[model samples]
Target: MDIRQYIDSTYLKTPAMAGTTIKENNEVVRSLVNEAVANGYKLVMVRPEMVAFVKRLLCVEKSKVLIGTVIDFPEGEGMLFKKLDEANKSIYDGADELDFVIDYKAFKRRDFEKVKTDVIECTRLCLDHKKIAKWIIEVAALSDKEIISITALVKNVVLTYFSESDYFNVFVKSSTGFYKTESGKPNGATIHSVKLMLENSFPLPVKAAGGIRNYEDAVQMIRLGVKRIGTSSASEIIAGEQVSDEY
Candidate 1:
């Protein structure tokens, strides 16, 4: 399979997260954007602030690499309006795809209704703007049962509110790749969790994000039917080498 099309070449770490200056962090973003242009990546996932820059750069190069940005980021705890505002701004800033971290904390609090509304309204905003929308369920933060339920929840919400034609534009993604875990546990996609997501979010597509560190892992996820693979190590993976697995 041509894994390049399925790869969402990602670089979402902020200056603080990367322990670098703002200029230095932005240089990395710019380089990633340039690399995407050179390598024919399907998309480049950047922070909201970098969307316009990436867009202009791609436009200059006449590159078809789609721009994706995260909404409410590693913490999906923002209120519904806050999430929508972030997403709207990202779209306005030239983001072709918005990966919204679901309000999974609310779901864990048993606030299923809030989660439903958040998903529906946020997705509506994306469709209205003619942009792709992805829901990051943060698999590392969820139990197996929660993974199943949340994936199905996103599928139902999308199917109920969006037409069948829009199904491909929406995806239920696996994680943020930034979650902290006890005992050095994986904070990204695992085969088991991905399988659960695939089983539950079928027909709506699944994006296995977070811990895809090598070509083998990406291929495995694709074989399991995930439509997209989000990772910060796209180059190393394509090179058949080990990736340090930064987000």
Candidate 2:
């Protein structure tokens, strides 16, 4: 397989961790974009604010790597309008794909209608704008049944509103790689959770994110039919080394 094409070489660090200043954060994102362009990775995932910077840089460098950004990231409990605002800003800044964090808390509370509204609105925005929409389910925060239910819910929405020709533009992604978890728990993608997502959300693509840190793991996910793998360790994975970074 052309593993590079399956990889979304990612850098979603907040400015606090990267640096307190915008310039400092851009430097970090610039390095990631540079690496992705040099290696011909599928996409460079970043924060919404950094999307324009990445777009400008790629335009200047004549790079073809796509730009992706997150919405209602890490936590999906934000107000629906605010999330829509964020997504619209990212799309305005030239993001090619949007990874949205679904409100699993609402789903857990059995607020299926609220969950459906959140997904459908954000997904509609993406589809209308001609961008890819990926729903991050944060699998580690869910029970097996919840995972299945949420995946099926997303699939139903996609099938209801979009044609088969648009299926590739939507995905049920696995995680944000930043959710808090109890002690001794894995807080990212696992084979079991990915299997559940794939089984339930088929016809819509699946993206395996979080906790995938090595070449073998990525290959395994691809073999399982994951269309994309999100990681900060894309270089190491492509080089066949064990990735040390957690996200």
Candidate 2 C-alpha lDDT tens digits along 142-182:
99999999999999998997788888889999999888788
Candidate 1 local accuracy as lDDT?
Answer: 0.91
Instruction: Give the TM-score of each candidate.
Output: 0.97, 0.97
**Global lDDT for candidate 2?**
0.91
Model 2: per-residue Cα lDDT at residue 208: 95
Off by over 4 Å in 2: 19-21
For model 1, the stretches where C-alpha displacement exceeds 4 angstroms are: none
In candidate 2, which residue pairs get closer than 3 Å at backbone N, Cα or C atoms, i.e. clash?
none
